[model samples]
Target chain A: MNIDPVKALEGKVERLGKDLKALDSRLENAQTDAAHEQLGLSNQLKDTTRKLGRTNDRVTELAESVHRLERLLVALNRKVRAGETRKADFGNWPEIEKKELAKIFQGQEAYSRKTFTPQEAKDTRKAIAEYDRRAHEAIEAAESLTHLPANAESLWRKHYKQWHAITDKHRPEVPDDDTHAKDTAAKSAGNEAIKRTRQQIRARIEDAVANDLLFPAWFENAMGPAAPPGRADDWLYTATDVVLYRLLHDVTSPADALGPAPAEDGHRKTLYDRLVSECAEYRRP
Target chain B: MAADPFARLADRQQSLRTALRALQAAGPGSPDFPALLTTTNDEVEAVMQARRDVEAARLTTPNRAIAAGTTAAALIVAVGWFDAWSLLSLLVAVATAASVLVDPAGRRLWEPRARTTVITAALAATLLTPLLHGWATLITAAGIAWWAWRTQR
Candidate 1:
């Protein structure tokens, strides 16, 4: 080894320079990589943020839909209850009509039995015609108003058809020269059948009530504590006749049997009271 | 509106109930009572009509096909566990199938919970044979019975 300190120092410095260059290159490369990684991370974060915003919007929409559905459910529940009450009220019409008819017929019958002058009889007939017209009008109103279940409607239709047949068979005719006797015979036969049918219906109603199969509280209230002792059958038959007339034909009320003016105030007032109560009950939840 | 007839009927029933409450609240004295009553009656008719429609709709072809598929799957599972336990599973599967077939509307049959119960029982029977021994099939019957009871309630 000759004395070459300067040369050796130069070599050492050159090696150090190379090492510094390499280090600098590594540091620069690392910085670039870090920057790329940060960019990637930023993009990912932005994507995630966008997705989160969409998710939040969706959740808000779903919550609104649930609220709407809840409101609908509450409204639907209330409607069902009201419909049930209305159905119950319509179901009561048959019983109410039966009770009212009973009173009307009883009044007509008592009047018919009393003697009256010609003028009074003519006035009575006119009143009877008016009552018949009213009865027909009531029936039309009921038919238009009532909407019964299928089974009940079918049963009603059958009864209506039977009533039409009975009325057609016994419709009164002008006393013609030759057909007067035949007309009388037919009327009597029809009346007998009507009476028999009324009796049967009354019996069935009584049986159903006695056996607790029916609980016509309204009917019982309308009938009051007691019907006149011997006139119960008459009352029932008269009511049945009223129903038949209402269903099928308009027949004169037996106002000829009624004296000058038939007092129907008691029966009318009682019926009105019962109707008001029924209406009140229908409104009760 | 619900596409399912039973669901439609339920909606109509709910509407009717609401109308009835409104009718009651209106009272007979209110001038609006008559109008409310008419609305209530209309709702009643709608409910009845919906019920009739439900009855008429009953089990459609798709429902029948699904029921048949379920029955076949049940039977296949039952066969896989052919033993004393198989009889119990088979009985349950057959009864469920029969009920689905016979009922006018397979409303309960189509319920997600009911389907889940039936499938779970079948899966339990299939998977738990080694661990539960013959008791796995019993689970099938019990599951079906529980589902039936729940539906009835």
Candidate 2:
């Protein structure tokens, strides 16, 4: 019995479209997951910026306080050096010193009306000085976090190389272009449809992963439950790695145009660098 | 200005125009070229709008301190002529003070070089009493206000 080739081809194309439509749903789910993760990161960055602004204000206040304290101390020392007071008055000088120190803590608006015992002023100054020191340390830490985007990029690169190796394992070599040209059967509409469908799936997956729109479900399904203390970063490594590997593995021969191949390690590094650079917009300036 | 986002958007706009032109030249028959060209044009417009938004966001509203500073500078230079606070001088001060205040960005309206020039002119004007020194200061203040307005644009 002779089979109608075009009719059979049409049936296959219809089935292929249905499969791709299903894959599209999964891609959407992944995209949603990535978007949520990005939102969390963005919120965290904003929080850090707010904290930085407050810290800057505190630093300014501390500097101002120190200046005021120095002036007060100089005035007190000048009065003492003038020898206008008797030695008997020296015992009560500490009380005066305490009052002056306390006045420094009270803001200028309320300073004249609000009375502070010498003891309270001394204690407040000590406490505020300690707070200022801690604030400086926090500012240092926040400054260091400016490098967080670079760290994320490096972590992603490491996972991508691992995924690439795993996916490449035991895979059949793709047939060469000359061989494909000779095999007319391989160039049929069915093959072309399959190629186009595959390209679309690959692109959607890459877009979802590259833009960090991939949901945790994409990673959890592949990597199992993430190790405890699961941050968005944990899934990020796996989701992007999977997408990158699939993208590289599914490309047509002409698309393998990564220029000349290097040593295996060098080739992976080149690809990693290229992929990281492509996603530079997501990274810090 | 060094980290201005609008400047970057403007640069993107130039590149986008070049790309859109190339795609448009590909003609309508080519599959995807029409869609690509349309998308590129949309992106260019988006960038242009964003640049405009950024410019609008940073638009310098008149600042009271700037107006006050201008009047103070005017008075400082006018001190030698009429009564330092003569009716005419004070009126000029009040009127100029009522004028728009210019906020600082990039080089300041009262930049060091401008400050030195104004101070030198005022000092020289002091030698010619009658407090005609008002013109030099008035002119200097006007120059600064002009510089600031230009910078904001």
Candidate 3:
């Protein structure tokens, strides 16, 4: 088949050549009779000016539409995040949408399959401080999730339970407040704090993608509450808060829970398993 | 053919491990672990006690300071506080608390905590001294007597 573009280019070039010849002839004739050709040149200049104005107007219209759309998307996310109630907020989300909401939902499931053995747990505890620090840096690099959006358009659906969750995860776990009186509570608090860092990393990822808010809740949730000293009947509610937040995230849509850890070999452990183990006492359901 | 419970248990346990392997690898096939679970409680408890004893034998005493502080606490309550020596008693109690402050073991037991506990006790004890004239003396005397008995014994 013949190429339309090449033929069109040839035709345009021929037309342009003819026009140039005409213009050249006119110019020559004008040199002899200059008054006749001046009006035609002015008319051509006006036509070009009108066409440029139309193109400029179209460009400006499209730019304005893009700017308006970007603002609308940001605002819609904030509204959706805000509308969530305690039970209803996370639980009611549709399946496919919630899955697509954050990378943690999609990315980390392979971690669970690792041989999540006691040996791994024992070994990990020693280096956990460093391990968690790296995880934190990784999370910060991912995205900013401050204003939080739900899957739907509801403005009243926002939820702050995730913030509460971080608080609960770091509660003083062992050395029961009464009997372990001789035991150092600072040690207990410190142990739980390390554990909490692992748990919060997931929630923060969720928040950053779902909300535009920086990790305010996650930061506040770090461990080491009042160490070594407590009144009667005091449990570290901080751990519970973190647990509840995770449970809330998890229970809502299994799809919505924090993603699994990266697979070490091929086992079925997850980030959720780590969170559950680290913040053991606080899990609600 | 087996000499004892462990030998019998080990054979049974071996079978159970095989079942555990199957369960962990895939799903419930021939369940051997469940049967062991029903039978092993008593044996487990006995084994756990034996394990604790072994651990206890190997375990060393905690830090020296903690032992010293406990000793001092026991002594202050037992000896120095007795015989109605109220001022002496106060001195002993202060000394005991101070030892905990200086000693690392005591730090482990009571450093961060008992902050409010000690403060409240001091405040309450201080406030009650004047009102508890005869009653207070009697109570103080009784405490001293108890300390004397504890220390002397």
Candidate 4:
């Protein structure tokens, strides 16, 4: 056991080196673990985003279905106001179909008669407006998280200031064009203006990131387009859009912005025609 | 308005908790096990997708230019000065030039085709500079040229 001191010291150094190497590997593993933790957090956020999108979609579908039911009630109300039978309005429907529709309408009248009066329609409009407000608020809240890269805020401020200066000097005046009668010329001008504005928007975006704006996770979760081109036949009109359109046009009922209900052959159908057609399919023999 | 996704998610969790409680209360031989399992699976998938979305969002780089531009344009509509707008044209031109110069990852600085197009556009702009009068024309010409070159290539 009486070993030389030099040899003993060398052995201790070798053991220390081995321990240091082991510690280094463990440290590397720890670093990797930290990276995985970061990834885990990011993954959790993504999961939330997807769930939100699904929920939003489901809600939109439910809203659209409710809107369709409301439309049917509204159409019935129109016939009642005109003092016309469902048969008279829906001419395309077979006699039996008209009767069936009448039965359906009458049954629906229990619900519609109570809540679908003109006053109720007005109330519905108000509710839809409120809903739109809430949606916009939520969207804005979600959009608030829109991340900007370094130096983006200052650049935006500068652009905002410049935009103020430009728009102040050149105010777009289209008061006359705001009327119900669609002015093609004004519309074209407005479109051109939009194009210009979009160009400006693109330029600003380009200036900021030299890339497309990062679509926020919440944005991805926002409800999908309600009216896809394929389903143009059964246009799922949201109550909000319909009410807003009617209000803006000062019309009793909103025009189906999603192209009017499908026409027969080459002839376009009126709202009355559509009501009849809808009634025909459900008519009883 | 659609139900807020966050709220909906919370509701879903609450529903799951309620279901789990019901299953527990019903004793060991609860017939709802299969349905619960299916629902749990769906939830897991949804959770996974949400996680993926989160990762995607993190990965996405925000375009500061667009944000600034949109903000500026919106503000202009709210409170703009039309007379001094032309003065800012120079600034816009400068911005456009700077944007082109600062291609992401310095790609524009490296790519040969991009360099050649930039040179050609600069030459064209220089030749037309005297006639065009303002930096607007020069910038516009360069931009158009660059865009056309890029698209064509």
Q: Which candidate comes out best when scored by lDDT?
A: 1
The CAPRI class of candidate 3 is incorrect
Model 1 lDDT per residue over A222-246, tens place: 3322223455564444333333442
Segments of candidate 2 deviating more than 4 angstroms: A1-285, B1-66, B75-97, B102-134, B137-153
Across residues A1-285, which tens digit of lDDT does each residue of candidate 2 receive? 228998888888999999999999999999999999999999999999999999999999988778656644653464456555322110112222333323322322232233444556666656555543433332233222222232132332343233233222221222343433333343343344334434444455444434333223323233322222334353344334434333343322332222234445543455555544433322211
Q: State model 3's lDDT.
A: 0.37
TM-score of the first chain in candidate 4 relative to the native first chain: 0.25
Q: What is the interface RMSD of candidate 4, in Å?
A: 18.9
Worst 10 residues of 2 chain A by lDDT: A86-95
DockQ score, prediction 4? 0.01
* A14 Cα displacement, candidate 1 (Å): 99
The parts of candidate 1 lying over 4 Å away from their true place are A1-285, B1-66, B104-133, B146-153
Q: What is the CAPRI rating of model 1's predicted complex?
A: incorrect
Which residue ranges in model 4 land beyond 4 Å of their true spot?
Answer: A67-285, B1-153
